[model samples]
Target: MRSRSLVVPAVLAGLLAGSVADPASAHEQVSTPSAAVVGAAPASRVTAGWTLVARYGFDGGRPTPIADESGKGHTLRLVTRNGGTVSAVRHGIGHALRFPGKCLTGRRCPHAALQSPSAPNLNPGTRPISYGAKVLLSPSQTSKGQNVVQKGYSATSSQYKLQVDGAAGRASCVLVGARPGIKLITSTVSVADGTWHTVECRRTARALTVLVDGAVRGNRAIQPGLSVANDRPLSIGGKGAYSDNDQFQGTLDDVWVRVG
Candidate 1:
C-alpha cells in the first residue's frame, strides 16, 4: 500500500535488467544433509548442498514484514528510528529493499533495518552454513563499509556476517566463535558498480569460503568446532546486533540462509 506511489528511476532499471525469477521450490528439508549449497532458490544456485532454512523474499513492494518463503514463518520486521522510510523499487527478481547510507541523507539510513526473531537455524552450532543475496549499489552512494546481511553485528560478535565494504569495493564473510577461532574470507571482486550481483558465504566443516557471482573469491581453513548460537536476531540491510550502525546503502533481494 505504501509503495503504490513510489517511482522507479531509469538508472535503477539498467542496474536491474534481467529475467525475473520465480520463487524457490524448496520445502522443509529432510534433515539428513542432502546438498552442499542449500535449496534450489534462484539466489542460492552457486552455494549448493545445504538445505533452506530461511528466505526473506522482499518481493513485496513494502519494507515491513519481509516474508520468509522457505515455508517456515521466520518473518522479518522492518525496524525504523523515528519512523523513517525504507523504499522499494523494481529489481531483477521483482522488488528489492533500499536503505540510506548515513545520518543525513533524507533516506532511511541507520534508522531503518530488517530483522527477524532469533531462531535456532540462525545460531547454527558447530555446523556448516550458507547464505546469499542479490544486491545492487550505485556509484554515487557512499557508505564506507556496510553489511548486506548478518546474524552478529559488532566486532567479536555472534555467528557470522556478510559485508560489502563500498569504499574498498570488496566483500567479506566472517564466522566468529571461541571454539574454532574466527574464519574470515574476503573477495577482491568489486560489487559497487551499479550492477546486480549475487554474494554468498559458505562455511563447511573444514573451510570457509566467500563467493561473488558464482566464483570463489576468498577461502580459509578452519575447525568445525564453533557454536554461533546466541540471542541475536537475524538482520539484513544493516548489522543486526550492532543497532544498525552499518546500514547498507543500496538494494537487496532474494536473501536465503541454509544451516548445514
Candidate 2:
C-alpha cells in the first residue's frame, strides 16, 4: 500500500527535478507552489477504460505547481526562453495557460512549454496510448507546424506528437517507430479558427487516429507491432524552451495522457 510519507517524498522529488535552477543559462524556472492545492482534475469519460497517467488543468495560475490531476504524481513545470511567458488565465469558466504567438521575422522569438520528468509509466511501450488538449488558436498564429504535445524526438528515437500544421491550421498526429521515417495523419478540418476545440490523438496496435471535438477527423494504418518508448519528457506547448522548437502560440487547457 502507498503511504503518505512515500507519496510526499515522491512529489518532492518531482518538484526538484522540474525546478529551473538558472533561468539565464537554462531559460526556465519552476514557480513556488501555493499552500492550498486545487482538487483533482475533473474526470474524463474519454479516459474511462485507459489508465490516466497525467492531467493538468492549469488551475492555480503561474508559479504554482501544475498539479497532475490523475494523482499519479507526474506534475508539470513551466519552461520559457528568450522573453517567453506563460500565464494562468480564466478560460470560459475554468483555467488555462496562455502562450504568446510567434514573433515577427528576424526578431528573437520567445518560447514556452510544460514538461514532466521521464518516468516509466509515461512511456507507453507497446501499449495503446492517448493524449490531447483543449486548445484555442487563431489562423494568424498558424505556421508550418506548431507542436501541441510530444514525447521523444524522431531524429533520435521513436516519438508521438500532435501538432497543428500549415497555414490552414490543420491538426495532425505523428508517430515514429523504432525504424526510420515518420508516420503521420492529418485532420481534414482545421481547428485554428479562434475557438476552443478539443483535439486528441490515439495510437492503437493497428492504427493512428486524430479526433477533433470528439469526432474522428483522420486515421492511418500502422504495423501491429510498432512501438513507442523513450527516455524523454512529455512536452506541451512546444518541444522545449529552445529556438525553433515548434512553439505553439495559443491557450491550452485540460492537457492529459492515458495509456493502456
Candidate 3:
C-alpha cells in the first residue's frame, strides 16, 4: 500500500557500466579458499543430497501467514517498522515480494522483513548448510550492505548469513562459529544488474562458498570443527524491524534453506 506512490528512478534501466566491488573489510579477516566453478547444476541436482529445511516459492504474492513449502512447518511472520512496506510484483511465471529501497535522504526510512520463529530444525549446527534466493536488484538499490537471509547474530552468537554488500551489490556468505572468528566469502562479480539471478551460500566443513547461478564465485576457508546454533529467528529481507537495519531494497522469490 505504501509503495504504490513510490517512484523508482529511470536510470535503473542500465546495468552497472564500470563498477568495481570494494575489497572485503580488514576487520573481517577475510580468506580466499580455492574456488571451483562446477558449472550450472540442474534444480534437482542442486538439492540432491540435502534435506530441505524451509522453502518459500512466494507464489500468490507472498500473502500473509506465509507458508513454508518444505512441510517442516517454519512459517514466517512479517515484521515492519517505521513506514516499511511489502508489495506484490511480477516475477517470471509467478510473483514475488518487492521491498522498499533506501530511506529518503534524511527521512526515517521504512523497514520490513520476514522472520521465522526459533526452530531447532532450522539450526544446522556443525552440519553443511545452504541457503539462497532468486533476486532482482538494480544498481540504485545497492547499499552499504543488505541482508538476504540469516540465522543467529554474528555479534552475540553463531550465525550463517547471506547478504549483498557495498555499491557493487556483490553477494557474500558469512559463517560465525562457536569460536571467536568469522569466515566470509564475497562474490567476484556484482548482481545489481537489474536482472534475476540465483545467489546461494553454501557452508561445508572445508570452506564457505558463494554461488551465483550455480557457479562458485568466491570461497573462504573455515574451521571444519566450527558449529552454528542459536535461538535467533531466521530473518529474510533484512535483520528485522530495528532501526538502521540492513534492509533489502528489491524483489525476492523462491527462497530456500537446506542442510545435510
lDDT of 2 by residue, 1-260 (tens): 11111111112233333433211232111221221211233223554699999887766533445668798988777666665767666775556777767687523787777788888888888888999999999988888778898888777767888888889998888887776557787777899999999998888888787788887776777787788888888888887776667788988888889997
The per-prediction tally of clashing pairs is 10, 0, 0
TM-scores for all candidates?
0.74, 0.81, 0.83
**Candidate 1 residue spans exceeding 4 A from truth:** 1-49, 61-63, 102-110, 153-157, 179-181, 240-244
Q: lDDT per residue, candidate 1, 82-182, as tens digits?
A: 34446777765366767764466433434456677788767887888888898888666645567677775333355687877646567778777874344
Name every residue pair that clashes in candidate 1. Answer: 35-49, 36-48, 36-49, 36-50, 37-47, 37-48, 37-49, 37-50, 38-49, 38-50
| Alpha carbon lDDT of each predicted model | 0.64, 0.73, 0.75
- In candidate 3, what are the lDDT values of residues 1-260, reduced to their tens digit? 12222222222212222111112212233554556534444223445689999998767523565779899989876677565667767665666788877775533777777778779989888898999999889999898788899887776778888988889999989988876677788888898999999999988778788889877787767778889898888888977665655789998888999998
Q: Put the candidates in TM-score order, highest first.
A: 3, 2, 1
The ten-residue window of minimal lDDT in model 2 covers: 1-10
Comparison by TM-score, 1 against 3, better one: 3
